[model samples]
Target: MALSWALASGAQSVTSGHRTLFVTLSIVVTLVTLGITLWSRHSTHTTGQFYTGGREFFAMQNGLALSGDFMSAASVLGITGSMSLYGFDGFLYAIGFLVGWVVFLLLIAEPMRNTGRFTLADTLSLRLRERPIRTAAAVANLTTVIFYLLAQMVGAGALVAVLLGSSGGGTKDVVILILGALMIVYVVLGGMKGITWVAITKTVLLLVVAAIATVLLLDQFGWNLSHLLGTAASKSPQGKAFLSPGLEYGKTVASRVDFVSQAMALGFGLAGLPHCLMRVYTVPTARTARKSVGWAIGMMGGFYLMTLVLGFGAAALVGPATIKASDPTGNTALILLAQAVGGRPGSLGSTVMLGIFACVAFISILAVVASLTLAASSSLAHDLYAAVIRKGKATELEELWAARYASIGIGAVAVLLSLLAQKMNVAFLVSLAIAMAGSSLVPTMLFALFWRRFTTKGAVWATYGGLIVSVTLVLFSPVVSGSPDAMFPGVDFQWFPLGNPGIVSIPLGFLFGWIGTLLSDERPDPAKFAEQEVRALTGAGAY
Candidate 1:
């Protein structure tokens, strides 16, 4: 279908046979994914099945799905692109992201699984006043989801245009619409079961593709790591500096602070993401959730290590000038790398290899968008629509209907925002999302789970205060203005010095929670604390 579309779509600039082959492969993969999603819809009969996969997935299966949920197109394209363009500075992002999983495994996984029923609100509401805490948590969840989903969709539109050989016209807009519709279908029809299977399948394919590409790249220098590094350094415009840090970021004190801020967000923020936290509920027991995190850490850490191969390989072979020419954001580095490593353009073998990588990238985008849609929809339905609107009396059927409609609504909003965000850097947006999650969700979660004196007022203050500060900082930061990479480059009203505000916003989150609790006269309930501690520790009352 992609091949047929390519032939008829009048994408004349992309006349190469290799380009056509990639389009065909991308279409084939997408169709198969759609088929599987439709098939999985049959299993989603109840709200429980739709929301949590009936809590039946084994630890390994859930682990792979978690990997899929975590590894977005931004990670594959943006990280590689950054590495290709900036060298060691880009790899820092990968390290930060990988270390986040360690934090998840050590402190968050078991307790989150044992305590939460569905969303982050479930865990928070266990020991706090239900209405205010759930409402606050829901708002925080939606904010993170909207920002993250918009980044993914924008990246998807740009990537689809590049892959389809049509960078101009309305091709990108059309592709965004179709992708949004497909994501809605995945959530409304297939639910958690379908999304989980898609994630699991995509994660394996992603890992396999990365490993193969890495080996082929290593073979270019006869498996000599030193030789590969030397060649890449020579090829880079920065020479030896490219092999070191400070190429992309860290030029000044402010920039260095920004780098640390971004690393802090990536390391602490990922564990608080609603989609990842929701995955904990898919497994039946806390032990399974713990084991799932172990699998995820192994897989994610290994995959990130391969970014060195793809990023440096691209710089070594294709050069940054060519990568930047295709997309100023360097998002097209990996695609060009595939073409360079796969023999040459117009050759059958090269075309096949390029197509495989294209499919890997497209499938990755699909899996992540589907997971985000599900997370957003579930939060709306379970936390707001059921808990708030219906006062915890909403029936299963009503909640399911709400979820389906919410998916469509959320997908539509994401598509619209993505179109506006096309000119922005995908990696920056992704990191910003992580930073916001870290500031808003992580502090509240830690306090609610660990602090015996945490109050409902504290939860609301922390969640809302962190969200407002993070968003405000981003709006006024260099990322939104002043710099060439800023979202609104034409207008320069930048106030914040650093692009990332995690350094300030994270501590503010914890501070707000503490201050709100102390200022308020609301006393801590011993019975509630005892109940939550037992459940969070022993998995006694977990669904």
Candidate 2:
């Protein structure tokens, strides 16, 4: 009922003229992205350029692209909306995300840059059994990337719901299909070069729009944060409690544990995200990868700080009641805030503000969808098809065709799944994907890089074991079937109390890897371990 009401409310809030403006902006942005893709296509004939942009991007260029890839619509629109409704608890997402980027830089990026050729599987298959190791890595990669794709598409669906404004289901489905088609073209025609530039373009626009919104918001309050906070608190339903941590996650012991688990997921998950790992190989040297991450951190940090102000600004200007009435999940908080900040409903400023923010959000979603699809298709071609099926005999032309077709297939699957699961909570799907990554990929990569005695069995175990446990736990948890906000609230099949399984699944992934290593009869390759260590640390003999 809340979901239906939220959708209907959101539909009613959008005016017909504003809806036309959104479509106009989307078309303009799509044409621009297509032009960028065409310009980059000539350079992407080889697999290296298709996958890593030929390792030629400077730190600043790649940094902005990294920021583009990392800062999804989920983080910008969703997190600001989250903070608008949940206050301090929602602020935790920014902290966890920033900290996770730092963790990836310090622990994951340099080693990956120094080691992998194409995919995350390349890094794991360094010394392990190529077939089984690549297979397992591909499975984990597809699992995480697909879930992320679904999350982004769901956000796209919500945007459609808002734009259509009470239109019939057929119209909304067409919009989603158009979106899917655009995403397929981005990956198939442009590849990494196009995707990188698309990301760079959208990231700049998103940051600029966000910064303007933040400055205008602050100006309304005389540049005094205290006044903003005071107004937000006074207008919020929870009042003073809205300024504290307990409003969202502190009501019960189980909820508190789930909050901690979620924090764990975000903190470690970014280190293991397949798409982020792929970004490392786009830089020439490990030092460049590190420097690029540094640049990303600085830019993303500025963006998150702006979100804090915007989140509060939304609450102060739009109020909790209007926000919840429009969208129960708070996804529309930014939109409503934009409308409010732009002056009267029929004014030109209002229309322009809505158009700019909506356009950037639309572009951001498409870019993220394309990136995820590319990651999955690349893994399918390079890891499973070339390595496992062809035994590494496939030519570059065959591999490229495989990747292009795979992108179309994966994009279709994601679009279909998004339509099917349109009623599911977008936040739940994203959290589950990250938790799975934290549990499965993190342990496998950590051991592969540092453990001298780690074996092929251990890597396989860690990857499959972590993924299986995370999904199983969530299936039986409140997030899936039991709670009011669950995907299937009509039933009560939940056995686990916590919403997130990260705290348990992550440790077990490591333990299972260790145990699997000890139980295997296979001997550890000390020579390979030594080479890996040298390459990971000193960039000597690195690909």
lDDT of 2 at 482: 83
Candidate with best lDDT: 2
Q: Return the TM-score for each candidate structure.
A: 0.95, 0.97
Give RMSD (Å) of candidate 2 vs. truth: 1.9
Least well predicted 10-residue stretch by lDDT in candidate 1? 1-10
Runs with alpha carbons beyond 4 Å of true place in candidate 1: 1-15, 420-428
Query: After superposition, which runs of candidate 2 have C-alpha atoms over 4 Å from their true positions?
Result: 1-6
Among all candidates shown, the one with the greatest TM-score: 2
- For residues 1-543, write the lDDT of model 1, one tens digit per residue: 000011112233233675677678777877887888889889888889999989999988999999999887777877888888888888877788777888888889999888888888889888788889988888888989987887777766766676676767387788789889999988988999999999998999999999998998899879998887787889887889988889867688897998888888888899888889899889889999999999998888899899878888888888888776666666667777887777766566567777788778778888999999999998899999999999989889999899999999999999988877666655556656777799989999999999999999888899999989988898888878898767677899988998788899999999999999998789989999999899889989888
Cα lDDT of model 2 by residue, 198-282, tens digit? 9999999999999988888888899999999999999998898888887778899887987888788889888888888888989
| Pairs of residues clashing in candidate 1 | none
Q: How high is the lDDT of residue 475 in model 1? A: 84
lDDT of each: 0.83, 0.86
